[model samples]
Target: MRPLLLLPLLITTASAADAVITYDEHIKPIFREHCLKCHGEDEQKADLNLANFTAVLKGGSGDKAVVAGRASTSLLFKAITAEDDAERMPPKKAAIPAPQIELIRQWIQGGLRESSASKSLVAARDTSFKAATALNFDGPPPMPESLPAFTPPQLKRPLPVIAMAASPRAPLIAVAGHEHVRLLDATTQQEIGALPFPEGQPNVIRFSRDGRVLMVAGGKPVQSGSVVLFEVKSGKRLTSVGDETDAVISADLSPDQKLIALGGSGKIVKVYGTDDGKLRHKLTKHTDWITALAFSPDGKSLASADRAGGIHLWDGTSGGILLTLAEHKAAVRALAWRSDSHMLASGGEDGLLIWWDTTDGWPAITNTNAHPPVRPAGYYGKLPNGVLALAFGPQGELLSAGRDKQVRLWAADGRALKSFASETALPLQTSITFDGKGLFAGDAAGAVRFWTTAN
Candidate 1:
């Protein structure tokens, strides 16, 4: 009888220790899911802001939520445990489960220990059951004890992740920050390694059609534009070319891996020999800064889009513009060629998704806008803002990330299938790609979020 009584106390102590909560690891996530949608940085319903600890402690129109050591009288506890539907928090579900509520109660009663950063990334994601634990393989990769020497710290004015690329042959995605590219395992959304290009923040990170090599292009403004080639698996830089005098924003390695083409603020598109870094051809037709580029899967055609709402389809062998696409009313920012090598997709600041038919004789733009529903636009307008990134799925489906922070799936005929709206407020998703089984989005906040492809 004595041992049995002590066993209950021991179990209670251990569970209490495990349940000790923190701001980022526990409370922040809870508030994010249930409260922040209504009282976050954007809206602040009832003048309550719970997005951060300071705001939560300061409370809202009601009063302070926590009183240091009392959980029974805390307004937060009362609202969440209220029996009346109108007075209940979250106002949707019956309420947070008793286990989580008990954890919150224990957390307030025991002095709100803010757990260290070592556990924040995985805290709220703990699995519930043994079987579920086995399936919970989603998270950031194990971070090193310290960042690599070449990797720059996330600066005060963080560099915008302007470019991201996904390999067609594997589950790897590359995201560009200031002066380096982070290669992530698309399935797990973990940082696998860093590919270093220290001259400047990379404007573009593109893998070859075979996915064996990655080409990076960018440099300090007006000084020199550099392009570097690195072996994908080993991170061994193979070649470097520093000749251009402006930022190189658009670049790609041809399917044959024999040539690399890039264009930038210099306004001249140039192709270089992959083996010797020698200039192969220079095509100067556009009058504005180049923004996006892609090579057809068959390696026959190269498409380059510019800031003037113009897309030039060039013959890879002759460097001549094959057909000029002028459907966008603003700058074209993203371009993707279907896997079949027959159709092209382009998106721009005008909130239009135009498909181009690429046949033997006639190549003209299709008249369709694969815009997702207007709900994500909030009170702004009928359509989401511009499309900043685009990708094609394995079976010719389309995926695009918009300025409205919605990622939408589309059929090949320009029909919207489903849309995933990001939960974070004011997330300007700058880049997006598909990795066969999942979709990866990189936003201006330097975070890459991955989600399972919704069928």
Candidate 2:
């Protein structure tokens, strides 16, 4: 009897020694010491606060930074577990200790739970879950369900891409680099087409409204700014528009596909007739470089944003200035007009996505640190920065690509929704087009990925 009792006592001691760490003991201290400075109770970095249990679960800018029951799907674990020094957590200078990382992993695998201290923290605070609200960004009209999952193909090139755009109709994706534009099949990682222009480093590529033409912009050394329109199917150059000077920074087409608007260094917007490639109008009102331009869904008005962060609206038919929208502190980079025509979304270098009410001339909604605010906006919340690409689901959930080579989902109102990584590889640029099915994304590495709404 005595020997049996001693054996049971020894087993209990060993079990206690191997017990998994809880939220209070192992996780909170690590977060407080390393992560809370940027993501804490007072300030939420990327809209994430890690000061307490509820906040950690609540997540930040995008949702599901961590999945409670699954460590593999948790972004926090992935970031901490990153192999590359540049991809590691704490961003530039900070590093997570090895023991702490192991502790987190063990806790997650054993079913993450709150400790006595964490329970106290929860008891001291309100721990109710708040349903996130919808954010107003433009894409396909919001749907009740998300699209199905589709993976993007990976490309061989490792060069960082600056801009990406999907073909209007086909599965072709145009990836803009320093001197070449790679045409990739949206469904397969295969390179079906390639356009090389050493004389011009294309900064942006946009398809014609009809999806019949591909327009390329930017210039090479000693070459003036130019715009080349090509037939998508044959890859044949349809028309080339340029002058002795003037580099085109951004371009867009009217809804009718008859008019083309180009903005760049000349402080002027040149409108051309697409049929004959003839110049029709030159509207000049901006004092700085035009960083972004878009035509309303109705094609009645043309919107232009400049480096000075001023938005100028023009009458599409007449070369007349309608109104100047101003509020951003830096150059505006991304612009989208909602289908409703009542709202216009503009993102700038300041990392804010502002939804402007065209009717009231005021912001209907605002999300700070919205994205990196670069040109040729990738998927939803994803910026063109080296970090990740963001997109919005049909249900208005935010989807983002992680530097750890993963894709994360978030609620439209900036709550983390879910997270998933490519089983194959990371994509260069991830984008979602509104095709009535679901959101589709294209990566730089030549992969087309899809995510369907869950029932």
Number of the top candidate by lDDT? 1
- Per-residue alpha-carbon lDDT of candidate 1 for residues 1-455, written as tens digits (9 for 90 to 100): 00111011011221124445777787777778778888899988778898877787788888887654445457887788787988898877678777678667666655555665322221221111111111122333222223344554567766556778787666778888778888777667777778777778788788775566788988888877878988775677888864887778788878788778888887778988877888888878887888888888778999898898888889887788788775566788788877777778888877766666665312222322333334543466555567778887766777777776776666665545666655453233333343356766667766666666433
For each candidate, give its TM-score against the true structure: 0.62, 0.54
lDDT of 2 by residue, 100-213 (tens): 886776565445667843321111112122333333434542111221222333445644554566654455567775466666655554555566545466756776555566
In model 1, the runs with Cα more than 4 Å from the true position are 1-158, 360-384, 425-435
lDDT of 2 at 238: 73
For candidate 1, report its TM-score: 0.62
lDDT of 1 at 291: 87
User: Model 1, 357: alpha-carbon shift in Å?
Assistant: 0.4
